[model samples]
Target: MTDIVVSTDWLADHLDEVRVVDVRDGWEFDGIGHIPGAVNVPFDTIRAAEHAVERGADPAEGMLPGVETWEEVLGGAGIEPDDTLVAYDDTHGVFAARFLVTALAYGHADVHLLNGDFSAWSRDHEVERGTPEVEPTEYVARESETSPFVDFETVEAALTADDVAVIDTREPDEWAAGHLPGAIQLDWRELVDDDSRGLKPDAELESILADHGVTPGARVLLYCNTARRISHTYVALRHLGYEDLMFYEGSLAEWEARGAPLESA
Candidate 1:
């Protein structure tokens, strides 16, 4: 298992050692059973309305909450700064990856995504129907030494830089509507396994990325409609050893709101 991804089998063995976070909605957490002892950190908990307001972007755009918000949400969920976290969701790990990215951005050193979805886990393993009691911890969120997040201006500047490759990780319909100029469209779904709902093998992932000229040596910038879907691709690239990575936080939402140039293919 890679540092960012942990298989079901590995998770089964290490369940006691790590905190399992279910990023699915609250209804799913109660109606659809979840991994035993996992805490349901609903998908919306990590987002804040103020992010858009603070950035002067569209209020409709989803954005990561501030560090204090993250600290409250994570600490209230009983997750400590040093705790190893394993996040999972039913949306082919997209939601889970978002939580992982949020944690990493807040300076959490140890975080991982469950290789498969909650359904996969319930198929062969035991699940619990109710919420588990959690002892809240005092989680201190440190300033990120090197954040993966990037602003709209930084991405705009990179549009003309030869050394950087901008990638749009949205769906075909979204891409068809509009996208950043010079941005390559590689739907985030392409990196996922159809059968397992997990990431594709590293070899296959590398080949697909290589075909798009997104090599390890190039500084890669990833963005989606609101920075949610691209989180999956971000984790995939990290697993493949793409060290120089940047995420456009506001994404196309900010771009369009700011009247930035866009091209349709």
Candidate 2:
């Protein structure tokens, strides 16, 4: 697996070589300065609104959009399937990781997340005030043959499967309120280093996961309130060389909305 995290210094050296994507809100991209030559692809644009309703889930739940939508949104942002993408956001890589995960799911092979937050970049490097010039491309996205995202049925089955480990990447309060039965709590924040605001060392991360019974050997299924928080943990696990990993896209929102049984702390 390719190294999914790139340092700001590495990004600075190769800014022109890669497609720099600022995954912040539109207002933030324009109002706050951004890395020069970077294109703004707001996090919300990549996620589907009212997607849960289609899955018999809450109407407010956000899920990954369809292939056509991804093709349009990414292509409009001047991103081709073969583009070397580096996505960053103010939220310590979570929003950026979400974009990377979505791109990977759509078979974009050379995607990466910028290590640390955008604030650190803006503070140290020169930034542009407005949108950069972009010429849109006709991008075609193909769904990956082996996708990391798993549906509700797969998650439901995993609950009873001894080999599968269902991990809840939510806060203590959220897990306390309710979570899927047999789901182990591993808050996504633990995967990130507080000082650097990037992922912890690989061994440390692996140790943390192992402590929670989330070993790489086991088939890991991760989820949060939505798919957002878990995206960070997903990237972290991938970075640590975990192969048999899956994400519950609908997550707790879908689980609860569908009247599935839940176990509270």
Candidate 3:
């Protein structure tokens, strides 16, 4: 498919032809088995620099890093812009989607996500229990118009847009704590299959979005604590044919840090 998600059988056949990225931490990679010939690229490696700062994230989570940063990390990991990539994570697709979003923001258009995540893959196929040798490359990422990677200012400005739906993809508790005014709380986990973390049946998802006042054709906006969980929601919405999809890169982490007003239930 031209879109980002891929099936297990499809991935199995293309392991050699495409670059398979295991977007899990080193410990997880060593403990849980991974796909053969896959390279381990941790999620945090490509995260925006502000996440590293202990204080108010100077920027915010999910903010796309600079060209030099992507060049170094992705290049050092042997990820070339030309290589067709399928990224996956055992953590229910959070890290995988994040990496895909980052890669796309930096103009790598060939990246896709494993349909059901690595956990689903492990259940159905044999997985190698060790890391594979990575042949690093000098892959330079050119900037593309990152349409969906919105910033705090853009999100704040779009809050009142007649055609926009600002969705908070956090848990109910988090939503109850405090959320952006008028932001609908639709937990990202609700949109996926329980085990595989793949997008749920299209009809079911369409109904869910409709129930929340998010029309299928609306310009959709998503955000969460750090923008990680929201990526799952973004992928699900995209699969459901929501064309005008965007993510608040500097999500609630940046919003609350800025002393922005929140509506506590």
Candidate 4:
């Protein structure tokens, strides 16, 4: 899997070459200005929101669906496998970064997350209003995700494993609310810094992961209430050369649904 990110300046220079996607809520896209030529692909559209609605799943859960659904959602946004995609969010890069991860899971290789997001980009970049039209394409998913993502079963098995590191990338309150029995706390926001509030310097990032016992050699599973917050940490660790990184997309909420015990620590 490719572990690279693009800066706002670079995106501005090649807006014509790259497919710029805004992954904010639909209302936010209408109310807030966006990058010129950018198309809306709200984060939920790429996730399992539809599936959740059909099955009566939790409203806040954000996870992936089947490949067919992914292909349709992406194609509807004019996304093709060969196109270079750069996604950004109005607030945090969670939605934007998740966009990149979701694309990879659907076999789209040329994807990127805009470093500073819309807030960082809008400070000096060109902004536009109104929506843009996009013609759907016949895109097909060739694989799931290139990065490691575990099912609830796999995560449960790892819970007792000595070598595996399970990290809870939620806020302290979320942690205190209730979490997986053996998860260690590591807030996602603290691991990143900069005007964009993205990943910090490589050295600092390394230190954060190291402190959490999530070194390159460790088999790590990261998660939050939903998958969005954890994805921010996943991106940072992936860039730090943590190949054994795994995303527990189901997270603790899914775990509880499975009758798994929780620890209110």
Candidate 5:
């Protein structure tokens, strides 16, 4: 399916055919560990600083690293270009979604976000964990120039516009710690079902938006700590037929770099 959410059973059945990624930050994965055969890529390092110049990232923001950069990483992890990618993280679906969106934008098809994320995966008692075996291969990531990245200029304009809604998809603690001014909080965890396993029920998602006063035609800007999890919210909103959604690609990292206004509430 174009909508990729795989069950634990499915993952187990096809473990070797899928390139599983534990996209959690260093601290999170360090303590709790990850799936067997899954490789670790701390979320922010998605853009290789040295290769950014050729990978479609803004030069001023630091370009995204080229295909060789991803090639080295994925190749080192024994990943094959033909294999499906399955990503997961502890931060609900935000990081996983962000990774999937960026991967798709970079032309990596056959990608899936593990349904219900790490929580659901951990619920099963027989699952195995291991330090992934590493091997080498010549890999390449095809780049796309039109991935709809939102920069500071766009964010500034949206902030002043009455028609736009800037969403902060961080956890409640992080949101309370601080956020961009005029942004609304919507923890990504709440957007998925705890039982059925993938995205939240459609009616429930619509009700959540209604509670937040987000309407169909609203121009929405979605962001999280690093723009990782925010992309999932972007996809979720789009699924609900929100027509004018954009992802703040660099997210709070870029906002803080630009000295944008922020507040704690």
Candidate 6:
């Protein structure tokens, strides 16, 4: 399955075929208008926990809600099991990528992240401004227990094992301050270079990994400040045909709270 990026023009052309999911929080969309026909899927709704990750915490936290909750949410959106899901958010696609990853984990065949997120779309003037009013639909409860995620315990165990490669997908500064023990640093920006947002290209991500001795079939456990940005790397790795890849959904905050062994490089 391919994760395709649709331009504003492209989205305009195939509005019916594609489902544009606006992942902005309530305040953002309510204050500012959103793309016409885009359904609001508030970022807060997909919480890792009742409370979220704290700033500057370790990178191994987040949780997937029960399948019943997901089914209600997806079904309420009128999402057909087979429709193409396109998710976007204002930031560097952290929210969008997480949602896309979540949906794909739920067995939705066609889920994509809007490149550069809503900010890029707005910069291109590719977005339509409107207060979308979607009628609440009757959601049928469909139970399925297949949420793709990794908890702090699993990450802690992997850190002690030589077989699993623990990757820190946070920035260089974050990596230097503190990171899980035995984890290798590979910034998420290495995968998606967003210079406009103070992100410089580590143009040779795969090469850098190769230098770090990350092999083709290495079992990777990817984590970041939050699971959001790292999910993009998770998707990209899978896209690159890596078979044994997994993302730590809770990320750094949770890991630090549990007092897991960490190293400052």
What lDDT score belongs to each candidate, Candidate 1 first?
Answer: 0.83, 0.81, 0.78, 0.75, 0.69, 0.66
Q: Where does candidate 6 stray beyond 4 Å?
A: 4-13, 50-61, 123-126, 138-147, 151-163, 171-178, 195-217, 250-264
- Candidate 1, residue 104: how far the Cα is off, in Å: 1.3
lDDT of 5 by residue, 92-138 (tens): 66677766776666667777877666767777723445454567776
Q: Encode model 3's per-residue lDDT on 1-265: one tens digit a residue.
A: 5766788889998788998888888877867778887888888777766554334443333556667887898887888888998989977787788888778778887888787887788887878877666778998887666547766777777887888898988788999888888889898777778865677777888888899998878998787766568777877777667888877656555577778888888
- Clash count in backbone of candidate 1: 0
The true-versus-predicted C-alpha distance at residue 12 of model 4, in Å, is 2.6
**For residues 140-211, could you state the per-residue lDDT of candidate 2 as single tens digits?**
987586468777777788888889888888888888899889888888888888777788878898899889
- Comparing 3 and 6 on TM-score, the stronger one: 3
Best by TM-score: 1
Ranking by lDDT: 1, 2, 3, 4, 5, 6
Give candidate 2's error at residue 93 in angstroms: 0.7
TM-score against truth, every candidate: 0.90, 0.88, 0.87, 0.83, 0.67, 0.72
The reply for model 3, stretches above 4 Å from the true place, is 49-65, 251-261
Best-matching candidate per lDDT? 1
lDDT of 1 at 226: 54
Where does the lowest 10-residue lDDT sum fall in candidate 2?
Answer: 53-62
Off by over 4 Å in 1: 50-62, 251-253, 256-260
Candidate 3 or 1, higher TM-score? 1
Query: Between the candidate structures 1 and 6, which one is better when assessed by TM-score?
Result: 1
Better of 2 and 3 by lDDT: 2
- TM-score of structure candidate 3: 0.87
Better structure of 5 and 6 per lDDT? 5
